[model samples]
Target: MDWNCKNYHTLDFELKKYFGEKAIKLSINGGFTCPNRDGSINTCGCIFCSEKGSGDFAGNVDNSINNQINEQIKFLSNKWKSNTYIAYFQSFTNTYDSVINLEKKYTQALNCPNIKGLAIATRPDCINENIAKLLSSYNDRTYLWVELGLQTIHKNSSDFIRRGYDLDVFNNAISMLKKYNIRVVVHLILGLPNESNHDILESVQYVCTKGIWGIKLHLLHVLKNTDLANYYYENNMKLYTQEEYINLVCDCIEIMPQDVVIHRLTGDGKRSELIAPEWSLHKLKVLSAIDIELRKRNSYQGLKFNQEQK
Candidate 1:
């Protein structure tokens, strides 16, 4: 029920703990495209990406930035009354488009009547000094957070996942944002096809050393119409069960650096297109199961880890 574990703090629990009120992220798709999918970096996009580019489960394209923020606020506020929100640009590479267009969309969201902040999800290679400055512009008025997808730090595993960029890209992005005092929330997917437990733990350790503000740990889900789906269909891949995934997650958290914010402990799957990982269909159950086991063993995040991780 409580959100804090020893090493990590869930986003919802952390926000409530700090602000003393309920908070939510309003998922926004700002009509942005990715260089990888557009043939700038790679042609097929990341291996795990859905045909709709992963934010299809979120809001619609016709929903303007302001409209999405307002609709989410109306829905959340009616129930929580005093809750606040972060406009999360989640769909594609949010920062890949021209800075002017990003500015216009972000400005509309930030200036919306009820939004409290913004959370942008983009690839590591997409961030730059100018983008950092633009993000810093709203820091004084809003709680700005950037989420970079670093699925795994091991180069071979990254290549296997077809993450499109390397560890150097992630390092530069974090450093640039840190220079402007912009908070970063990194995303890493667990249970990747070929990664071992050692690989998973190593990735967690590497990300911890980068000094990010938060982390979103996800299990790789095989959605329909993607290369990963074909892998599953051809007997080349597997999904974790509820128990297997919980153990992996608990282990990752126990080794994660203590100060990181855990934005999510699991992923939300698009039920219609999902192939394996049927356990993800009941995300809340998975979380509750993980929490119970963590408590049972009296273990918490960073329980056996150190900040001086290499």
Candidate 2:
């Protein structure tokens, strides 16, 4: 059987089609903060967030953006050997700062010799007309993707996770980004506490109706020293087993539209920080299982998609 997925679009294929070559993302921490953590909203931050603000796999925050990108390029050169790179601002609310500072950091990345584009991860509430305009100006110069963290659309799940914004906020952000022709990538988490399987699928369907570019599907990870960890210890929270997760992800992929690139299928938690769902450490195994299960079902992405849903 052909191992390449025929039913769905992968990030690698999309990148190759656009850049005409293999381009790897170099994670960069822009030393940004979030309203949820800075007293602008709340102080506890997301219940599942780590001390590093979801930049555990990203480069050192203390280093300058340019330095971080350079260091990662040097390290990844030995592994991927691809000259093309995307400067991914992965930590915290990348757009929380003023427009002037945002331009400075983003411009610095664009000026890098090897960088081909920029991917900024931020919250929906943090965006506005001024910021959207500033980001749109780069559309002609280089590729730009605005990543929004929307763990789940369920109101209860959103509240449990301490996500400060509402679904309307996310919809408005998407509308603003689309107005500027900037690509949007949404982040969704499966197996959130108290959310049913139906809830997760509904979230996926909702995203498909919106005019977005890509989606990153992640498994809820319980990390050490976080409120989630404490809750797990106190309430005996249960996470999905490996087999259960594979089945759910395959189902999610089937319903996803073929044009929406699947940016990621699973979570990548640092071993040192991970507290539950130990099987997530074996990332390759999880990916292979998804592939195998899809083959078994003779299903590909969009197998269950309905145009009317959009």
* Residue pairs in clash, model 1: 7-301
Best by TM-score: 2
Q: Candidate 2: RMSD over Cα atoms?
A: 1.5
Q: TM-score of the candidate numbered 2?
A: 0.98
lDDT of 2 by residue, 1-310 (tens): 1214544688888998888889999999898999999999999999999998987889998898889989999999899878799999998999999999999999999999889999999999999999999999987789889899998999999999999999999999999999999999999999998988889999999998997899999999899888989989898888999999999999899898778988999988999999889999999999988988988999988889897877
lDDT of 2 at 298: 91
Q: What is the clash count for each candidate, in the order shown?
A: 1, 0
* Model number with the top lDDT: 2
The digit string of per-residue lDDT tens for model 1 on 97-189 reads 777988998999888775787889999899998888888897767888999988889888789778888789899999999999988988888
Q: What's model 1's lDDT at 220?
A: 87
